[model samples]
Target: MYRIQEDHLDINQLTQALTESSSECGAIVTFVGRVRGSSEKNRSVKEIYLESYLSMTNKAMMEITEEVQLRWSAVEKISIVHRIGVIGLCEPIVFVGVSSKHRKDSFEAASFIMDQLKISVPLWKKENIEEQGWVWVSAKPSDKQAALRWRL
Candidate 1:
């Protein structure tokens, strides 16, 4: 399952939902991404504003989830929830969870989902700096490389 919402993420609830449905799986890998307090350039960040076209974002997330299943057949379940709008520093922004019979598949699938989302999703981020003001965040080369590594 995947969702794009503006409300704050509840990590515990999301984890429970993902694990409860996959009791047969032995491994559950989860990742929670939070808003950083500082920018890549080491500047103080007050908050982050995220925006997305809901329909397009949902479609992209579904495609990514499907690809994960195709690549890792052992995966029993997957969950991805991303929050948009203004988020305070250190607030949870995204969650990715994967359950499988083994640790390897669960970990790899979770990582792949997050890497793909970073590059393929249509979400935009604007950082609110403490002193400099708001600045549109650009994609990083490292993120692109990470996603490319998963390609066949």
Candidate 2:
């Protein structure tokens, strides 16, 4: 499942849904990403405005989920939920959940999904800084490097 919403994310609901998706799964791993107060640009972030090319972003997320299952055959289901619009500091921005027959597969699949989302998804973010005002966030080299580690 892939979702892009303008409301706050319900982490519990997402995890619960994934847990009930399959009876064969023994392990479920989830990753929750939140907006931080301080960023690498040394700006004090007040809020963040997120937007996405909805159709394309959702497509990419689905593709990433499919890739996870292809790489980890034990993975039963994957769910990704990303929040758009203005989000306050310390609020959840995204969620990735994976269910598998074992802990290793679940953990690895969740991690891979998150890394790929960061680099491949068409989501854009604007930071409302305390002093500098709203500024568009740029891609980080570290994020690209992380995604590169998963090359087939």
Candidate 3:
């Protein structure tokens, strides 16, 4: 399951829901992304704004889920919730949860989903730097390199 919302993300709720169905699920892994007070390139930030291409983002997320399932056949469930709109510093931005029969599959799948999301999702972010004001956030070279690790 995947959701793109403008409200705050309830990470615990999403994770609980992901593992609710399967009794065979022995491991559950979750990744939560949050807005930071500062980045290497930006400091004195107050808040951030996120804008997403809704339909396109959802499609991309679904594709990522499908790919994860293919790569980790033991992965039983996947839940991804990404928040948009104005997000305060330290607020949750995204959540990715995976349930599987073993820890290894769940861990790897959760990491893969998050890495793919950073690059593949159509989300545009603007940082509200205190002195710099709102500046558009671009894709980082590090993010691309991280995503490249999953190429199949």
Candidate 4:
């Protein structure tokens, strides 16, 4: 399952749903990405505004989910939820969850999904900085590196 919305994420609900009917899986790994109070450059952040091409974003997320399932055949269930619109600092922005019979597959799959989502998903972020005001956030080199490592 995958979704792109402006609503705040419900961490508890999402996690429960991931384990529902997933009794066979021994591990359930989940990740929640939150809006940070400070930016990479040490700027104070008041909020972040996320924009996305809805249909394209959903399609890309679905494709990433399918790829994860193929790469980790032991993965039984996957869920991705990304929020758009304006989000306050420390609020949850994205959620990724994966269930598998082994902890290794579940952890790796969850990490891969987040990395792919950062690079492949069509979502843009603008940060409201204390001094600089609103500025568009760019992809960090470290993020690209993280995703590249999975290719090997």
Candidate of highest lDDT = 1
lDDT of 2 by residue, 54-148 (tens): 98998898899778878999998888999999999999999999888999999998889889999999999899999789999899999999999
Off by over 4 Å in 2: none
Q: What tens digits encode model 1's per-residue C-alpha lDDT throughout 22-137?
A: 55688999999998999998989999999999999999999999999999988998999999999999999999999898899999999999999999999999999997999999
Candidates' C-alpha lDDT: 0.94, 0.90, 0.90, 0.93
lDDT of 3: 0.90
Model 2 lDDT at residue 36: 96
Compared with the true structure, what per-residue lDDT tens digits does model 4 show for residues 1-152?
99998888999999998887466799999999999999999999999999999999989998998899899988999999999999999999999999898999999999999888989999999999997899999989888899999999
| All candidates: CA RMSD (Å) | 0.9, 1.1, 1.0, 0.9
Locate the minimum summed-lDDT window of 10 residues in model 2.
15-24
- Which model is ahead, 3 or 4, in terms of lDDT? 4
Error (Å) of candidate 3 at residue 135 is 0.3
Candidate 3 structure quality by residue, lDDT tens digits, 1-152: 99999888987788779878588999999888898999667487789999998999999999999999899999999999999999998999999899999999999999899899989999999999987799998899899999998884
Clashing residue pairs, candidate 3?
none
TM-score of model number 4:
0.97
